[model samples]
Target: MTHHILKATKENVHLGGFSHLLEPALTIDSGDTIDVETYTGYYVYDKAPPEFLTPEFVDICQNLPPERKIAAGPHLLTGPIYVKDAEPGDVLEVILEAIAPSLPVGFNAIRTGWGALPQQFPQPALRFVRLDLVHNIAEFPPDSGIKIPLKPFFGILGVATPETARTSIPPGCYGGNIDNRELQTGSRVFLPIFVSGGLFSIGDGHSAQGDGEVNVTAIETSMNGRIILKLRKDLQLSTPVAETSTDIITMGFAQTLDAALEMAVKNMIDFLERFVNLSAEDAYVLCSLAVNFRITQVVNSPQKGVHGMLPKSIFSHKINL
Candidate 1:
């Protein structure tokens, strides 16, 4: 079947979270999927400065308005593309098809307060890298001058919060600002439907990033992507879950390592319970027996969120393609 296409330009609406700009409310049928094509969070900054080897340039670029900025906004969600029969207690499965970069946007390296390794290198700085998508490599022209492998991820994706408006910069259960790098293509992301039609949006696409994206930036770029959304009408999930062909991924967040782990465990427990329709006890046992948790980050302050996963084989079923 042909997928419905929606293209967002610099004009039209708030570029906050990607889900805010969904199309006219349309009810989604069970098993039906919507494929969305997106622009780089940079939205319209067609070219990036090739010599972003200092924090000064990054500061200048980041301060520009959305239209003039070189990187994408904090949020770039698409639509409240309404799912017809969706309701609370249902789960929305976002099958990530691809999240490759549309261009080699620049990377920003901050000084003191921004990096996980800030103290180790007590100087403030910024640098830009050109990405080679085909080779999955990044070129840093600075002193180190070494190329690095690229891992692309969507830094944010979520429905509107059930509570008051939250800043798009922080990662929370509502799926905002979660910089989990494994949320790459071919991964299945599961989020609970908090409101009607599961109003969803996604943007803040990154060309490449490290865990925690600690430097407060990545190879931020915008690109088109296709996501298949499945409506799980009978289940409720507290946090998000991702399944790859080889792994079952869980996410955790907290103010501390312990809290992040707790969040991760709760998230996994929620996944097991709702995905398999198991009771609480059974789900916990399933997590212990078949799940392996992976730490996604430990540097997000105020609270840190973690991500864990188990191989799909451990669950006896391959991740549905």
Candidate 2:
């Protein structure tokens, strides 16, 4: 397996949307590993202090052309990396090897009309946080003494969809903006490919975030990550699924939380039946006994998310699927 490095630059980054029309920044074969750099917060760049901004971040914010910006969304995503031989109907298995803070600072914000509690808190608020990299903690407020442990992950890890232009704000079958805290290091995300070459992109780095991301933002920051891409023609999946060492995660996104939950549960049942060779009835029973459905995020308006996590330990034998 070859190792490649992708830098977050104005030429390589796409602001706010995904499309098959975007040219691939880099092309690599299946089983290739990429050490990718990602930037965050296109709209909040001006609000960040000069001292906290990295040279790369500043360059991207200043030099990116206006036309590159997608008005419907706010994330600054890196790449539409072409995975060689990855075709439509195939699955791209992205193995997240490692993730780290690329900058010492991050930001969290609550906009006037955004977040889960917008009516109650109408005013906009932004907080700049410093990361104590040595301690693996975020020194929130500098003097508040509230040091939150960093659990960094990319909020967007997705491939191009069938649509020519898709907003980066919501998580969908292609897996954009999935704010699941559970997808940390040593996790594998399986995305169903739509367009050929599986034009993959990554962005919206979060140093730390809660389950629901209730306030509309996390500790948004630049991140450095290493991931291995493998083509899986053997697996036929319609939506994104993930797995860590202990749990298998099936995600669903919809207009309402109840609909998203139902989709997640049904997907989990589908997974158990297809991979574990269990009957539909048995899988439904197993879901009630072992699956824990969680609200992944609520702030990605009109597209809330739910994820069902089934513990791998429940099965006594090995599950290769």
Candidate 3:
């Protein structure tokens, strides 16, 4: 079968939140793979050379309609693709295949009130970064021009939120904006089937980002990547699980550390309930036995967030069926 490909554009849908436009019935046949071209997290802004901040910057930014700011809000997703035969009781496995640069050029910005360090830094900064995927490095000025290793990842990937009109800013059971870095190539991302075909979409590609993304931005860029969808016909996972090149991870995000942990843990509980057939209390014990929580950011607006992981080896029994 021909590989299915989708081009994301501003006209077909809004720049950042394209997943909102997906029809739940969109189908991906078994063994079918897809290539998605994603824009920078700022949408088309990456196409221009870096523009220095000025009073006009804030004026131009603030003058934008509230919804137009940030090119759309945090964590824009691009798909709710239905995996044929996937059902509410089954887990959907998405295998990341290739992740490459869509735009050879990449840029990220820090407006006065944006980012985790905004208050502490209190200065606006604009920068041009190179994500030479050929070299797998992102360069910046340290004491001088310096290059950093690239660890690319998606800032958003999730099933449609349980709430039909939900804002994509928050991370929840259905996996919106979780911001975990481990969802890289060679990883298997398993998500719950809230609606049929386990609608799945992924976007908001980042070239490199520090944990917590404290600056409220990362080496955000456009990318072209491919993923193959497979279904767990009878089994299901409550939250999302990813088996990366180096580890297996489960994730959660929330407005507070405690609440973040709750979401993370609850997600694992749901996984255990579906996969291991454990009761709520047993799932709790299983999570305690298998999960480790990792904080992604403690400073993003509205609330902080965390991501949890359980190594694939944590469970002695082979998890693959």
Candidate 4:
């Protein structure tokens, strides 16, 4: 496999959305590995301390053209990298190899009218935390003696949608803004491709976040990621699915939490039947006995997420599914 490096620059990024019309920043074959640099908070760059900002981040915020910014969302996403031979009906398997902080600071915010409990937090609040790379911890309120361990991951990993432009704020079948904390190093996100070349993009780095992301944001920061992209034509999926070392994750998003959970459970059952060769009845039974459906996120408005995690250890024999 070949290794490529993609830098986050004004020319290589699409602000706020994904569209099939955007040109590819880079093209690579299946099984290629990319070391990508991604930054976040372009809209809030002025609020950040100058010392904490990276040069590339500053350049994008200060130099990006106004037309590049999409009013629907505020994320600064990098690339629409074209995968050679990837086409509609195929699945793009994004393998997370490694993720590290590209900057020494990150911010978490609770904006008015945003977040799970927006009514409770009527006023806007932003807190910047220092990332201690040496210690691999986020130092919150330097004097408070509170340090949260850093578990960095890119919050967005999406392919171009069929729409003219799709907002980056919500996670959908295409996999955008999926704030799942479990998607750290070693996780594999499988996205169903729509347009040709599987124009994939990545952004919205988070140093750490709890499940649900209740306050609307995490330790939002710039991150460097090492990812391996492969074309998975053998798998057919109607929505995004993921896998880690210990469990298989089936995700679903909807307008309500209950609906989202139902979708997730249904997707898990579908996966069990198709991949594990279980009957529909057996899969339904297994879901109740073994699957743990967790709330992935609720802050992404109108698109709450739920993920069903089935532990691989439940099966005694090796499972390729």
Query: Best candidate per lDDT, number?
Result: 2
TM-score of each: 0.75, 0.97, 0.77, 0.97
Off by over 4 Å in 3: 10-14, 18-26, 41-47, 50-77, 86-89, 142-145, 162-164, 266-292, 299-303, 313-316
The residue-by-residue lDDT of candidate 4 on 236-301, one tens digit each, is 888999998889999989999999999999999999888898998999999999999999999988
lDDT of each: 0.62, 0.90, 0.64, 0.89
> Per-residue lDDT tens digits of candidate 2, residues 118-141?
999999998888888999998766
**Root-mean-square deviation of every model:** 5.7, 1.2, 5.7, 1.3
- Residue 249 of model 1 has an lDDT of 76
Residue pairs in candidate 4 whose N, alpha carbon or C atoms collide under 3 angstroms: none
- Candidate 1 residue lDDT tens string, 217-286: 6776555677777788665567776777677777777777687887787877776665656788987887
Clashing pairs in 3: 79-201, 212-296
Q: Which pairs of residues collide in candidate 2?
A: none
Which residues of candidate 1, in runs, are more than 4 Å off? 11-13, 17-35, 39-47, 50-73, 109-112, 117-125, 141-145, 269-291, 299-301, 315-321
By lDDT, is 1 or 3 better? 3
